[model samples]
Target chain A: MSVVIEAHNISKRFFLGERNQRAFFEDVSVKTIRGLRRLARRRLAPEQSSSRDFWALKDISFQISQGQTLAIIGENGAGKSTLLKILSRITQPTTGTVKVYGRLASLLEVGTGFHPEFSGRDNIFLNGAMLGLSRKDVRKRFDRIVEFSGLAKFIDVPVKNYSSGMYVRLAFSVAAHLNPEIVILDEVLAVGDTVFQKKCFDRMEEIIDEGHAAILVSHGMAHIRRMCQICLWLKNGRIKMLGPTDEVASCYEKATTHEVVAHYEKQTAEQHGPTHPSAIAGLVQWSVQSKAASAPHSIIVSQAKVTFRFEIELTAMISHGKISVSVADAQGLILFTQQGELGQITRGKFWATLELPFLPLKPGEYIVTCTISEADHPVAFLRATPELTVLKDESLAQSGYHGVLNMPARLSVEQIPQA
Target chain B: MAQTSSAKETRVQSVPEIVTGTNDALPSAKPTYVVDADKILSSHPKDLWAYRELYLLLVKRDFVAVYKQTVLGPLWFFVQPFLASLVFIVVFSQIARLPTTDLPPLVYYMSGIIVWTYFSNSLSQVASTFLSSGTIFRKIYFPRLIVPFSQISMNFLNFIGQLLVLFGVIACYKLSGHRIELSLKILALPLVLADMALLALGLGCIIAAATVKYRDLNIVVGYTLNLWMYGSLVIYPRSAVPAHLQPLLALNPMASFVESFRSCLFDTEHTTVQPAVIATLMTIVIAIIGIWCFAKAEGTFTDSI
Candidate 1:
C-alpha cells in the first residue's frame, strides 16, 4: 500500500484584481493612473493592494495509496476544482508541496485539444499526444482505441461532423485507454448515455483493479458512494471531514440539505413579508406544527404526531368542498397526499385542523402544501410552511434503509440450530 | 498500516494472475515528482527530449493542415514569394533604378524575398504562440518550448518550398547565359538560416511572454515586423547604402543574414566578418533571454489570461 500521491498543506492564492476585461488602451490608461495613486498612498495605506488577495484553498492535505479511490465532495465554490487543478499539476499551489510517486494523468476536460477540422484518425493521434502518450504508445493502442470508441467506420471523417454522442464516446475512449499509474478525473462520468456511462464505470473499476489509484471530484453523490472507498468533504476551502466514504458522504448530504432549508427560509422571508393575507377565495392561512420541533417549523423524524392547521374564509356558499394536505420532497415530487371533506360554510372565517397519529419520513428537506377545492376544481393552494426539515433521530441509526420513508416495523431475531 | 488490510479487502479479488505479477514488479523502482510554486526559468531539457515526438507531430499537423482545400495548394508557397519579388523588381529595380549587383533582377529580388519571408514569418508566428493557443495551453500540460520549436520548424518547411522556387529562377537565368557564379558558399546557406531562426525564436519568446500580460505587444509586433523589413537590406543591396549609413544597416541583425544568403547565390561578399559575428552573438543572447521569459510565463500565464 505504497502512497502514490501526497499533498502537503496545499494552499492556493489568487488576486481578484488581476481580472481585466477592459479594452487595451483603456486598460493602459486606467492601470497607470491607479498605479500612480497607489504609489502616492503607499505609506499611508499599505494594505489597500493586499486586500485583493483571495485564498481559494487553505491548508488542504491528503494522500492516496495504490489501488484506492478518493472522492472529493463539496458545494459550488468550495475549492474542489482548485484542489483538483493543483493535484493535476495544471496550476501550482502558492504555498505548499505535492509529490507523486508514479505516472499521473489528469482528465480535466474531455476531448481537450481536439481540432474539429482534423479527421477522427488524426485527432486520435493529436489528442493522444496532448495527453502525454508517445507516438509509439498511441500507435500500439490505436486499434484498441478506435475499437472502443466504435468509430472505426468513420475514423477518416472530420470530428466537426460527428454527433455529440460520438464525439464524447471518442474522447472518453482515449481517456479510458490511458495506462497511467494515477488518474485524476473531474465530473467526467456525467457524459454520454446511461449504457455508455455504465461502460465507463466498468472501465474505471478495471483501472483500479490493475493497481492504479484515482481521485474523483464529482457532485453526483450516488456515483461517489458507489465508486469511492474514501471521501473528502470540503467546506469553504477547508476540509470539513475526511474519512470512510459512507460516513463522510452521509455527513455531507445532511449538511447540504440543511443549507437548502436555510436557503428556502431566506427566500420565503423575502417573497412573503410579515403579513399573511389570503389572495384566493377559500384558503386564508395554513401552517404546520410538530410536537418535536428541532427549529421553528422543522419536524424531527419519527415525530409520532404532526398537525396541519388551516384558516378558510368563504365569501359565498360552497358545496362539496374538499381540503388536502400533501408532503413533497425537495424537487416537488409528492410523497404523501391526504384529503378530508370540508364542512359546509357560508360567508365566514373558519378554522380546520388535520392531525396525523404518526408521520414517517427520513431526515431531509421537504415541502408541505395545502390545497382547497370545490366540486373537484382546485380553488386555492397555499404553502403550509416555508420548508419542512426533518431532523435525524439518533434511534434510527441502526436501520439501514436509504429512502424518504422511515417505516415503523418491528424486528425480531432468534438463533436456530442447523439440522 | 492499519488501513492496509481493509484496503486489500475492498479491492477486486478476481484480478488476473498476470496483473498481480506486475504489482510485484512495481515496488522495485518508480519515478517520483515533486511540484512546488517555484518553477525554474530554464527549459527542462529532459522533458523536452521526452516530448520530441509531439514536436514532430505538431510540425506535421501544421504542414498538412495549411494547404488543405486550397485552389493551388502547395504551389501557393511558390506563388507568394514570386508575386512579392515581382512587386520589388518593379518598384526598386526598374523604377527606382536600384542596382542588381551584376545579377538578374528576378534572382536578386527573389532570393532576398524568400530569406526575409522565412525570418519574418517565423518571428510573427512564434510571437503569437501563447495568444493563439491560450485555450490549449490552459487545458493541457506539455513542454511549452515545443510550441515555439514547432512554429520555427513549420516555417522551415515553407522556407524550403520557396527556396526551390529561387533555385528554379537561378537555373532559368543561367540557361539564358547570364554570368552567375555558383560557389560552395551555398553550403553555408543552412548555417545562415539557422542563425536567422535563433534570432526569431529569441525575439518571439520575449514578445510571446510579454503579450500574455500586455496584449498590445501582439498588435504592435505585427506592424513592427512589417516596418522592420525595410530597415534590413532586403529590397536594396548593402552596397547601395551610403557609407555613412552602412554601419546603421549593419546594426540590424537580419541585414547580415539576408546579405550572406544573397552573397551565397551571387558569388559576392558585401557583409564583413565582424557584422556576422556580432549578429551571431546578439542572436545567442536574445535567445537565452527569450527562453527565460517564456519559461517564466509558462507556469502562471493561465491565471492572468
Candidate 2:
C-alpha cells in the first residue's frame, strides 16, 4: 500500500497568558521599547517576558498508508485534538511538516459549516462544499445523504428548529457520503442514538474496506480495538506507545485504570479525613492478597483463592460486632458479598481476615470493600489499597472471553441426540 | 507560479523545500497538499480555482441569507442608500448650504453615497473575515481566500442594487429639465468598480490579519472608516475643498474613484486620467501587500482566535 499521509516531527507551541491576546502592533512596539531599555541599561542578560510557553504537541511523527486505520488514544488534554487539527490543516504546527497525497476530508467536527438558519437541504450542500466536494458532487449524493440521515421529511426545514440529534444526524450524513480518499474523524462517532452510531460504524468500516486511509481520535477503547489496526497512545504531548491496536489499547487501558484507581483512592482519603488518623475506633489498614499473585493488590490467575484483611483499632470492647467483605467492579456494582460475626472482641489493634476459596471474576479492575458494624450500625468503611487487578491466566488466554465474569464451568460433550 | 516560488525563497525562512518534489508515486490524478509552518504560497491559488463552486455557493448563501428573514427583503438595499442620501441632502446641502455641482442635490449625494457604501461594505466585511468565519475556519480547512472573495461578491450584488437606484434618480433628474451630462465615459464604470473592490479587499486583508491578534483594530476600523469617508470627496466635490487642501484630499485612495464616478455619470468635473491611473497603481500595490499578509495570517490565526 502506498503511503497516503506522512508527518515529520510535528510540534506546536502556544503562548499562555495575556500576551496571546495582544495585537500584533502592540506586541511589536512593546518589544522594541524593551530592547531600547536594555540598550540604555547596557544589560547583557537575556530578556525574559511575562508570557509562558506551552507545547501542545512535541516531536510527533507518524505515517499511514492507504487502507490503514490509525487510532489515537489518550486522556483529556493529552494533545489528541491538537494533533488532529494539525493533520486536518486547521492549524499549522510550530515546527515540522505534513504531506497529504490525496484528496482529504477531515470531519474533526460534524456540522462544521452548517448554518442553522439554512434548511437541512441547503446546509447539506454548504457542508459538502466546506468538505471539498463540489456542488455537482453534493447534488449527486444528495438523496443518499438525506436518506441516511432519515430526515427526508425535514430536509426543507431550517436546522435551527430541528432537535440537536436531528442536526447532528444530517451533518454526519453529509460527511459520511463524501468520497474522499483520506478521512480524519475526531470523536464524531460518539453521537446520536445507538442505532445511528451503529450506522456510522458500518459506514466507516465500508470506507476502510474501500482502501481509504483514516485517522481517528476516540475515548472508546472498544471502538479503537474493533476498528483500528494501529494505535498511538499519547501522554503529555509525546507518543507513549505505538504498535498493533490490541497491544497499545491494552496498555493504555491499564494506565488509565491505574490513574482512575489513584484518583479514587485520593478522593476516599479526603472523604475519610476528619474521621481518620485520630478516630477513637475505626478500621485503620486493609489489604487484598492472593497466593497466585505477588502484589497484594493484584490477582494473577483465574479462580485464585483470595484474602481480604483489615486491622481495627478500637478504644472499647464490643460483643456483637460484624465484619463484612464485598467485591465490586469498576462501576461500583457489588459482585460478591459475605458477612462474618466477630464474637466478643476487645480491640487495641485487631487483625481480621475474610478468605475466599475461589474468586470468580474476570481479568479487570475491581475494588474490595470491608465494613465493620456493631448492632446493625456501621462504624468503619475501608477499601483495599491500590485496588485489585485480575491478570489473565496465560494457560486459559483465549480471545473469546467477554463481559466481566471468569466463573469456572465444565462443558459436557454428551450431547442430546434428537431425531 | 515562478513568482510565487521566488517569493517563497526570498521570504519565509522556515518554509521547507518541497517534500514531494515528484508525483511519480501517486496512483491517480489527485491533488496533494504540503502543509508546513511556513508553506504559505503554493497550491492556494490553484485551490481557489478548484473551489470556485464553493465560492459561488458561499456568495449565494450570504447574499440570500442576509435578507432571507427580513420583512422588506432586498428592498432594504435600495432604501438604505436612498435614505442616507436624503439625510446628507438635508444636513449638507439644505442646512449647511454646501455647493452642489451642476447636478441635482439628490443625484449628487445619492451617487456618491452609493459608491462609498459599496466600498465601505466590502472593506469592513472582508476585514472581519476571521472573526466572522472563525467557527468554520477552525473546524474545516478550505482555501481561506474563498471567504473574503465570497464576501466581496455578496457586497457587489448589494452595490448593483443601489447602482440601479442611482441611475433611476439620474433619469428622473434628466426628465425634470436638469442638463445632467450622461457621457460615454460611463463605460468605465466597471473598471472603476473593480478598482474600488481591489482597494477594499486589499485593505480589508491587511486589517483582518492585524485584528486577529489585536482586536482593538476592530474598534479602530469602525471609526477609521468614518474618518476615512470625511477624507474622501464623498459628501462634497473636489472643487468645493480649499485649493491648498486638494492635494491632501487627493492623497486619499478613494478620491479619484468617487471623482471618476461623478464625471462618468453627470460630468460634474472632468476626471483627469492621471489620478485614476495613480489610484489604480496604488490599489494594485495595496492589494498585493494585503494578500501576502492575509496568506501568512491564515495559517496561524486559528490559534490566536
Candidate 3:
C-alpha cells in the first residue's frame, strides 16, 4: 500500500505568555528544564517532554495508506485541532514534518472562508477557489452544492442574512463537493440539528467509500468507532496509543477514566494532606467486599452481591450520627444515597449489606463516594471508591441473578365476564 | 567510488523525506516587516497579475454598492461636491471675502473641492480597509494590499463621476463668456490623481494596520481627516494663511496636489511645482513605510483581529 500521509517526529511548541511581557528569559528557563528532563529520562522514559512544553503534539509519527480512514480521538485540549491545522496548512509544525500524497482540503471550522456581503452564489465560487478548486470546477459543482445545502431559493441573497444553520449547511456543502484527494473534517458535523448531523455523517461515509482518505477529529467515540478502521488516542500532547479502532477506543476509555480518577485523587490529596488531619477527621475507612471467592477484580452491579463494610474510627462518641453511601454519576448527581443504622454495630466497626436485585442503571462505569458526618460536618469522605461497573444482565445467570434493585410487591388479577 | 555511492544514497533518501516533511508548512509564508519596499512592490505585480478578476469584481462592487441603497442613488456623487462647493463659495468667498488665486471664487473653490474630495475620501476609507474588511480577509487568503488597492479603484470611479460634473460646470462658465483656459496641461490631471491615490493608500494602509491592534487610531483618523480638510486649502487660498505656516502647509501632499489641479484647470501660475515634487517624494516614502508595516502585521493579524 502506498503511503498517503506521513507525520514523522513532529513537535509543536507554543509560547503562551502575555504579548507585552519579556518572554526571553522565561522561554530560556523552560527550554533548559525541558532539555534536562529529556536527558535524564533517556532510557526509561519515552524521550518526550509531556509537561511544560504545552506540546500540542509531540514526537507524533504516523503513516496512513491510500484510501484509509484514521480517527483522531481524545478529550478536549488533546492537540486534535493543532494536528488538523498543521495538516490543512493553516500553521506550521515547530519541528518535524508531514508529507501528503495529494491535495488536502479541511473544514477545520465551518464557514471559514465565507464573505458576508457576497451573494451565496458568488461566495460558492470564491470559497471554492480559496479551497484550491478552479472557477470552472466550482461552476460544474455549483448546482450540486446549492441543492445539497438546501439554499437554492436564496442562492442570490447575500450571506449576511443567512441563519447560522443555513450558513453552516452552505459552507459544508461547498467543502463536501470539492474533489480533493484527502478530506479532513474537524467536528463540523456537530453543527446543525440531529437529522442534519446524521445526513453529514452519511455523506462523509459516502466520501470515504469513494476511496479518498479522511482524518476525522471528534469527541464522539461512537462516531469514531463506526467510521474509522484505525484510531489514535492522544493524552496531553503525545499519542498514548494507536491501533485498530476497538483496541484504541478501549485504551482511550481506560486512559480517560484513569485520568479522571487521578485528577480526583490529586484534588482530594491536596485538600487533605498528611499535615491537615482536621480536614478529614473523626471517621475511618470504608470498603465494599464481595463474598464470591473468584469474584472479578472489579464487580459489575448487575451480577454481583456486594456488601457495604465500614470501619469507622470515631474520635468521639456521637449520638444519631449516620453514614451516607451515595453512588454518583460522572456529573456528580447522586443516584442513590442510603443513610440508616439498621444493621450497624454501635461502637467501633459497622457493616451494612445491600444486594441489588436488578440493575436499573445503564451499562456504564460510575463512582461511589461515601461520607460519614454528624449533621452538617463531614468526619470522613471517600470519593470515587470501588469504581462500579454495570454489566449486561445475561452474565448473571450462573450467580443466581442478583439484580441492581431489591423490591417486594404483590399482584392480583380478577377477570370479569363480558356481561 | 565508495564515498560517492554513500553520498548518492543519502541524497536519494533525503529528497523524498524533505519533500514529504515540508508539505504541511507551505501556507504560512507571509514575510515580516512593513518598510520592505522591494517585498511590497514585488508582491503587488504578481498579485495584480493573478487576481485580475478579483480586482475587477471589487471595483464593480464598490461602484454599485456605494450608491445602491442611497436615496439619491448615483446622483449623490454630483450632489455632494456641488453642495459643498456652493457652501464654500458662500461661506468663504461671500461671507469671509477671501481672495481667489487669479480665478473666479466658484471655479477656484470648486476645482480644489473636486481634487480634495477624492483625496480626503480615499484617505478616510483606505485607512480603514483592514478594520472594515478584516472579517473577509481573515478567513480567505489574498494579497492584503488588494483591499486598499480596490478602494483606490473604487474612489477613482467616484472621482471620475465628480470630474464629469465639474466639466459640465466648466462648460457653463465658458458659455456664459467667463474667460477660462482649456490648456493641454489638463492632461497632467491623471498623474496628479495617481499621486494623491498612492499617498492616500500608502498612509491609509499604515493607519489601517495600526487601528487593528491599537483601536485608538480609528478615533484619531476620524477627527484628523476633518482637520486635514481645512489645512489643505480646500475652501481658501494658501495666501490667506500666515507666511510662517505656508511652508508647513506646502509639506502636505494633498495641498500640493490640489494646487496643481487648480493650476491645470484655471491656467494659474504653477505655484505647486515645488510642493508637487515634495509631495511625490513623500508619497514614495509613505508607500515604503505603509507596505512595511502592513507586511509585518499581516502574519499576526489573524490572531489580533
Best candidate, DockQ = 2
User: What lDDT tens digits, residue by residue, belong to model 3 across residues B1-305?
Assistant: 21222222211111112212213443333322111112221234564456656665666667776766689899988888888888988898899998887677777777777787788778888888777877665444456676678788888888888888888888998899988887777888788888999898888879887776666688898788888888887777777889989889867888888777787666776556877898899999998898788765664454444
Query: lDDT: which is higher, 2 or 3?
Result: 2
Residue A266 deviation, candidate 1, in Å? 5.1
- Model 3 earns a TM-score of 0.66
Model 3 segments beyond 4 Å from truth?
A1-104, A112-135, A156-163, A206-215, A226-251, A258-419, B1-69, B95-103, B136-142, B182-189, B231-233, B236-250, B260-278
TM-score of each: 0.78, 0.84, 0.66
Judge the docking of candidate 1 as incorrect, acceptable, medium or high: acceptable
lDDT of 1 at B32: 62
Model 2 vs. true fold: TM: 0.84
Evaluated on chain B only, candidate 3 has a TM-score of 0.84
Question: By TM-score, who's the top model here?
Answer: 2
Itemize residue pairs with steric clashes in candidate 1.
Answer: none
Q: Using DockQ as the measure, what is the rank order of every candidate, best first?
A: 2, 1, 3
Cand. 2: chain B TM-score? 0.88
Backbone clash pairs for candidate 2 read A23-B214
Q: Write the per-residue lDDT of candidate 3 for residues A349-387, one digit (tens) a residue.
A: 454444444435544456666665555445456553446
Question: What is the C-alpha lDDT profile of model 1 across B121-199, one tens digit per residue?
Answer: 8999899998878888766677788988999999999999888888888788789887788778788888889999999
lDDT of 1: 0.76
